[model samples]
Target: MRKLILAIAAALPSAAVAGGYIVPNTNPRDLSMAGSAMAAQDSAGAAYANPAALSKLEGLNVTGGVSLIDFRSTWTDSARIADGQAVTMIPKGAFPFVLFAGYGLKLANGMKLGVGGGVNIPGGGYSFWPGNWPGRYQIVTVDRKVYGMYLTSGLQIMPQVRVGGGLVYYRTTEHLIQGINFLGYDSSAELGTSGGAVSFDLSTEVQPLKTIPLTIGVDYKHQAVQHLSGHGHFDNPPPALQGYGVVDQPATHVLTYPNRLEVGASYQVIPQLLVTAQWTWERFHVYKSDVFNGGLGFSLAVNRDYKNGYTLRLGGEFQALPQLKVRGGILRDISPVRPETLDPTLPEANVWAGALGVGYEVMPGLQVDAAYFHAFYDTITAAGADQAFPGTYDTRANIWSLAVSWKTDLLQRRK
Candidate 1:
């Protein structure tokens, strides 16, 4: 009975972590370049991509955008009796949306600063699976939402070096449902929670050579630890299990968002061509376990054993016309989830992605950007990972984005 309760508590965190919660880039131009915009800091997105690059701007800048994400996934039980039938799952509404907005300014004193905010699906993928699916015992439905706000500042301390930092605040809400089997009878468990955390990031940009149009950028984001308190409800427990911590009660848990490091370089190979390459690393190993505390002195812990993950990105932009820019890029993202810790709720695998985008100057100080991105995930087959659940998992995703940016030289106007 205690074991079953622990399993219910454990499933909640896995569901949140395994839902592709991390968004690579929210800006349309950055996404179009496969997230390789760290060093090419010409857009307002530099506020989030590399705050140090904000120093490069000479005016007031604002950018707003939205991304529509379409995610699809399937799971197949490994049991012989189940044959090869697959269960499909998808988010429960119209295509999910990620939003971004940024504001930047270059002060009269030559100092630069920016404030950016956005809505990210970090843990908020409203995925729904059939109640009778083979993996129902693990997870049935999950609804989560996370929001972030960024305040940043940048300074060019030297002729060739710029440094910056930012503070981040995140708020999250989660609700999950999973099926339970008590002997032959069927039951269900539900958990709801909400919490917030604060974190920070630092960045630096450097120009090494006097005659070269090359810039190197490095950025680091600290980890955030969230403590959530909420309620847990269980239904249809057997008569014997009614009094044994099986009742509805208050619950609490802690979840840690990983820290990250990104290093990138951008160079202008020609007057009309710019290229960028970046490498990103995330410390996912912090997600070692889930500890849950419930009413009636019920406490349990479950191991996750996640590892660190990394990504490689390559991108380029070509000035095709005086008023138009063309962009394309590719990326390879490696997952941190291992076979030993694989769960139906966290079916993640390595992926390769490609993107294309275009920016058109609508007016002297206004531009419109649009992009399309697609990700191909490697199918995963996990056997003997769990006696109750073993299966194959496949996933696919696509993103479409649009944005408008406006910039004006405030100092120039004063002069």
Candidate 2:
């Protein structure tokens, strides 16, 4: 019995985002416009969003930026209280951030090349309470982090058509701790895992009508499966479980990060005014592995049964002045988690988000950008049916970002 339980604990957690995870727009300038830069990428973000748009960029351009995300939530379970106290848990707000940098070069005859990479802390939060808390057995502390890097390129097929794509590498790390009753003795378990994988992306853009100021773009990113291996440790084990001890297993489980597809269009309403809309589809249904079989007869599995999800975004940009531009947009995303699986590890929910931002030309070849975003989510509730946790989860988040990019013709002049 002890061996079976320990083997189950060896499996790590999984990641699927319908809200507050897998942020598509990493550029501060684009985030300001609610990630509407798909068809109107005027900055160095082309390398990440739609590499096909690179042809629209000129000369040598370098961009750098960062985004700060703040997470807040409260979990309540009246039936699980132990000491006749308030049945509530408020997670300490977490400040996770993303960093980005990219460079693009325009070659002769409408050809473009770009290389870029960044770090994304898509989803992961920490929760803590006294060891005697009623929900202690469910969870205590969970720290999960995911990040990725990529390189891309683009070319103009015709005067109004372009195509692009790139390759990516991703990594995820997780740590979880929970309390258990062992022969009437208080005991705790710690589990850890870390692994990396490779993926790729493809994109294209076209102007269907030259007489109109309209541009359409689309992109696809392949899914990644992280194969991780780690260990489990027990503290203060009771005599019955003393034989289990500390077990160190290496590289055993696998987690799937869903694939994604996005399509966007931009229309210039007037000379200086532009409007854009985008739709994104996440193939969460393809995520089937709930258990990871680490080699050496060690394996773990959990049931997620996630469903596919989508996001809709709309934004507009105005060239208020020759040197300044203003932008705003809104988004609605559906959650992928099925109700029975809602737990502290991933308290996900449907969300509505809005953003406001602006860009300014510090000089002829230098641009600075800034934007702010807020997300509101629906409360999640479960009655403990089907053996799932019984409780309510309320959550929300905020983000702030800033960036700078420089475009120069020095390379062209040197030639």
Candidate 3:
């Protein structure tokens, strides 16, 4: 009841806010160490990370953040090039959005219930530089958008424990584009796809220690199956050389859906300070299909889908004043990618981060928040993809971000 609305402390800048190589495969935020799910309370932002935290909110709230990812992925092997020519430079971009809204109501018995939803960017791929877009292949663009929502109810089942659970729904759209050769002619082909899924979350918050001002919460979230496919189209067809062929743009690639699991926790050192952590698991090997083609309108090929991976996050905050805060966090992204599935498009790695922010109350029921953060990643290989590709190439990336949050009371005055 003493926490004031924060604006700068919760928002992120452009670079760290979007999906990129080192930042995160998904949306980045200014919340804390654990960028995805935070230890925040009262604000509508908690719903995206843990629905059970929604009951703690006292009013109707809305929050949204954007993460802009900047990176470079290049092809270094002259042998991989079609005509014995190698690529030295590459440029790419990914802008991801994370939206959130929440509302809470108190019952006659004093228990709380809440609901919230949003559009999230799980990941993206856009590695198009100068020479041949790297690897033994190229991708003009790889964009994806995902949406989901949840309704949760928390009951003070006992004096020290609160139990809660909720159902979730997801929707998505993904677009893919790649260019090879027009066979001496000038032609292009691009593809687009759409898919969705459903999931659930179960959580509990408990006050285990009485002497220390503290509370702990644990949450689990799972996503259902999501199927995806993209259709391709040809523009202008080029000519052929030596009968082998020259393509301005070849076919496209298609993939199926996968599942995900997430677990997180939050701890408060005092009314104005707290720390948090989270782990996420995603299964891509469940992906099945064959051939990454381009000759026709699409590309298909057999692949050794990678195993699941984990993202570990940790962050905390310090309130210099009632309305100001300084924060920082770090994440280790150990991908389960195999040497065979490696492509220049999605080269996984580990990332580190730092952030600062401020929040304010301009008037009753009205508030504004802002935040800043920086993320760093170590180089990794995008090898094993494209039968034409030979070895894993070297690469690295950096993400910087800034964000804002605004909220007002609709039904009641909550945090």
Candidate 4:
């Protein structure tokens, strides 16, 4: 039974590792270009990726899209008596959906304005672990959901320069179930929490030369921390471990969303082709929270020591035909959680990614976009100190997106 309690402990730390959540590509067009929207963006998506882009539009534009993520992983126990055998304790895959929308308007004052928003699913993952599985005593199941919303604006300072910013909000819900061992008896508890937070984002773009189709873009976003409060229901437990038979106790937690910055450039080598590159830095070190004061003033401490993370992305778009465009790109994503902080609650690892997509000009003012992306993660083997959940994790993910955009001159003032 003691082993069961320790196993549960191994999975608990991950519940607080929310700072590692990655927002998958929300725009189908952006996904196809491997999320290289920092500078080479068109349509209303610019409202979120780089609002300054709104100033380049001719009239009014609206863009909307939906994305589906398929995440899968394989976990193994090195200490297995069967000599390093794979464990089938958890679900093999999870599917999550993302939605996005943006609108841009070109005013008569030579200024551009735009608004955009999106719904992101916490990257796909499994929350269920079998009670009889080797690691069941450590964790039975964990489920979490997070939603984000934002309103953004942009202004064109000159024909070749623009700047923009926005306010963002988030809501979160979580549920956890784990088995506990005490006095030779096995019991379980169900815990849940809900909370929200608000943050901000800023961005800018510049064109240095008029003769070259080259542009530079920079973007930044503030950090947000969610203060969650809820309760836990303890199932039947040994008398020595339970104050009252199957009672409830207060539960509270905090999740820190990291701050991030991105800088990139895009160039149109020719009238029919565009290429881009970008780098992103994330401050995941802020994910330090060893304790939380509950509703009744009791403290619950959970340690999480994480490092900063980074990502590099490159992409291109080619005008294959008068009515169709082809896109492709690649990226490298790094993880912030060190080996010691790695846990099964949400296994995270560095990844290499590739994408492909296409755009169809269905009509004079309407376009449709579709894209697919795949991420290949490095196999992680944890066996030393800080390897709280000592095991091996193989992870990978795939994403599919589709969107439609429309533009019209109706919003322009009649001459």
RMSD, every candidate, angstroms? 2.8, 3.1, 9.8, 3.5
Clashes of each: 1, 5, 52, 3
Candidate 4 off by > 4 Å: 1-19, 81-83, 88-103, 106-109, 117-126, 236-241, 244-246, 413-415
lDDT of 1 at 207: 92
> Between which residue pairs do clashes occur in model 4?
7-138, 8-138, 340-386
**Candidate-wise lDDT, in order:** 0.77, 0.70, 0.50, 0.70
Candidate 1 on 200-261: residue-level lDDT in tens?
98999999996999999999988889898888888778879987677778888887778889
- Model 2's alpha-carbon lDDT is 0.70
In model 1, which regions exceed 4 Å deviation?
1-6, 13-20, 91-126, 235-241, 385-387
- Predicted model with the maximum lDDT: 1
lDDT minimum window of 10 residues, candidate 4: 1-10
Best-matching candidate per TM-score: 1
Candidate 3 lDDT over residue span 1-415, tens digit each: 0000011001101112222211242323334444644334456655655556677766677776665556554445534455545454345555666677777677677676666665555444444544334432244445555555555555545446666667766665655445545344433444555666677767766667666545566666664565544444444433333233322333333333344555555666777777766666666555533334443333334444656666777767666676566566666666555555555445434455554445555555555554555545454444433644553444445444444455555556432
lDDT, residue 83, candidate 2? 34
Superposed Cα deviation of residue 205, candidate 4 (Å): 0.7
Cand. 2 TM to true fold: 0.88
**All candidates' TM-scores?**
0.90, 0.88, 0.75, 0.88
TM-score computed on alpha carbons, candidate 4: 0.88
Write the residue-wise lDDT of candidate 2 on 338-402 in tens digits: 76776655666888889999989999999988888887878877544664456667777777888
